[model samples]
Target: MVTSQSTESRPSLDYEAVIGLEVHAQLETESKMFCSCSSGYVNSPPNTHVCPVCLGMPGVLPVINRKAIEYTIMTGLALNCTIAEQTKFDRKNYPYPDLMKGYQISQFDQPLCSQGWLTIQVDGVDRKIRLNRVHLEEDTARLVHKDGPDGERYSQVDVNRSGTALMEVVGEPDLRSAEEARLYLVKLRTILQYLGVSTGNMEEGSFRCDANISIRPVGSQDLNTKVEVKNMNSFRAVYRALNYELERQIRALNEGERIVQETRGWVEAKGITVSQRSKEYANDYRFFPEPDLPPMVIDRAWVKEIRDRLPELPDARLARFISQYGLAPNDAVVLVNSKPMADFFEECVALTGDSPKVEPGQRARAVGTWMLGDFSKLLNAQGMEIRESKVSAEALSEMLGLIDNKTLSGKMAKGVFEEMFDTGKSPGRIVKEKGLLQMTDSTEISGAVAQALESNPDAVSDFLSGKEQALTFLVGQVMKATRGRANPAMVNSLLRKQLESRK
Candidate 1:
């Protein structure tokens, strides 16, 4: 059996690390935050999706996007944050090429949401990670650096991504280990996907994270110098970066070196973090209220409407899968991790009549097995998601129905499934086309069984001499003779009857 690695196995480190994450999720809004430019500029040429307000042209009055605010409020409510009755945007002044207007429109003293918490389970134990705030801000333009013809480095600014709606989720320093940090991010992404505000695709740059990690002595409450790690594009990168940072900080303290507060970038190829620059304090941004946009006044009815529209989240869905379907907790977790995959699984189950004739627990177990087993393997091999798979949910349900009704044996179904996954054919059609149905006909199976007994008399003698395993060997011979299409239980019964008759 497999086991989880235990922390106690390693040498105990006297210090503990405090970790907090700032996740920025680009909203799925069509237009720019303050202008009419399209935000869907992924593959479009740089600078094509620009306008007066987004391009930092002078005297352009900025207007807020209503859908952006509603999305932020919806996410805030999903995170259990309190919506501020009065909130407004502020100017965060910074000098960077990405900041088109020499500043970013963000929130300061009055953010739209505050004081929410999310619960994460680590090592089978539940822990609540507090949220400091969930705020909204306009995204900056992307900076593309390339090498010139002579190997000289030059940077180009693409304003196509400028002024996009970006929501920031700031978490408390509640995480202690890298595993907990990963779990927190995964849970956060699931929530965002369910909210449908963001795609939560890290590789596509829609969802990004910056981690602030600091190591301190155990049982001490005082904070220490923290380094912010950035440019982690995936969950694995984030986990590895944090763990590497933890080791680096712990080693520095052991060598009598002081830690410095700075911003670092994750070097994925080097498997380490390199210091980029000194970390900036909040005052450095020089935040001030935005003059052009008016303050937002949210009312009770608005909050209630958004809250009522909230769909079921991961935790609740996990519980329902366990209690209603009688699935194991771990199985429920895998099913509920991805919203689309979970929906597909449910659709397959619904098509099977949920196996009404069979035991509900048995039927649920079978469905979960196929999903987490061969189906998952195929998806991984092709590097595609369930929605992208050639086999539809209806096709898989038909295959499972055949197994439940004994129309196809388990071994035969495996081959039929492979054909379906490759050819996008229905399970029934593949079975019929390939003549892969089980040999339930007594006459066909009996002929194969008699031939096996005649050729394997030595094995039959062993069975009579009280070797119970000899019976299994003879049964395998019969299955092999029938090309694995024979009903295994019937073959075993016939083999026993023929051997007893020889006595």
Candidate 2:
């Protein structure tokens, strides 16, 4: 049982964590890497999608998936990697229950892409994490562990995912903390999603990560023995696992225990990493050129075509959001980090037309405020993504329009927006059905202001004596009396008029 020590209880040490990550994203190809087997095997029954080629049957020849190669190159270009004009596949000899072929055909010395870097922001500082290589490989089958009725543990092999195209993004050890590692993963995942090469969903095992972490004295120039941590399926898990492993290493070093170079599994429930096996070196796999498949000669025209066709990435979109929408830097960063959210934001902005009443920049800022404020609050409370929300971009724009036209107060619109999110109803329909229209009528607002002043004589007296806060109390009274339907500007104006007449 592994336990985590709280920061307050842990001893302070002059150490810094050196972390690197190997992320495996299963490509969104239609078929397996070397076979025609369907890659859409996530929902299929075990062993149903397997073919003789994926099974490594004797006398079976494997063919490469051209689309997977293209996707890998696209990913490399997106990461600013150097695409290799010549690349080949090699056999990685390994014995595992999940390896259907007893060896994987993967890129070894000659990867399709190498020498890339991505920028990640941590603590408001931008750091570029270097990429060692981005290589293509086939995924192994899954091992399903089950408990037998007689209290015995047994494992079964599911070959459905055996031959799926997998891209391994190996990062150099440039990270100094768990937070940096998490940010790096997030940036990389965002890039992958923008490229449309992978779903980048860690929960579904399409995007998986294995982290190598070690700690050295803060001023040390040498790298220490690192432990590879696996089984972390989420970003939060990765952060926690790395922090825990860092602390564990610090404690071990303090106690003069030798740090072993080994692979460990992150126990999510225990919040600690447990030793699994010794780390394997490249020679352990006995990598050799695979004779079954031929080398790939990528064309410069193809690379240029893919690069030209690349969509607007997160960083570029961030800058555009700031300049195009006139949004604040922080607000634009948050929106552009998630592609779906950013797309939804642009859609909402587009629906909000440029009129004298609502300028384009004003409309964009208003949409950003709502999206980053109450709309986000509700979505988070319900655990829904922007694309999965019941509220459409059109509906949100309509609600903002109501606010702009003074048909609904900001408070009233909050309720209307909540209803819109809940039932997927139009803003106009919800407003009409719930009688939540703003009380813009001067006569009606005057009456409410008068009643509030007559009832709250002490507040009125306080206002007469120059208490600025008294006016705020009276405005709240008016809003409450009108069930939050009164236009706030109208309420303040009417209240000030009535209060001045009293004085």
Best by TM-score: 2
The digit string of per-residue lDDT tens for model 2 on 1-503 reads: 12333355456557889999999999999999999999998898899999999887899999999999999999999998999999999999988888977899999999999999999987777889999999999999999899999999999998999989999999999999998999999999999988999999999999999999988878777799999999999999999999999989988876668998888999999898999865364437889999999898999999999999999899899889999989998999888888888989999999977667898999999999999999899999988889899988999999999898889878898888888888999999998998988888999999999999989999999999999999999999999999999889989988998889988
lDDT (CA) for every model shown? Answer: 0.88, 0.91
Candidate 2, residue 315: lDDT: 88
Off by over 4 Å in 1: 1-13, 279-283, 354-356
Worst 10 residues of 2 by lDDT: 1-10
In candidate 1, what are the lDDT values of residues 384-453, reduced to their tens digit?
8889888898898889888877878898888888888999999999878878788898888888989998
Q: Please give the TM-score that candidate 2 achieves against the real structure.
A: 0.95
Alpha carbon deviation, residue 51, candidate 2 (Å): 1.8
Model 1 quality (TM-score): 0.94
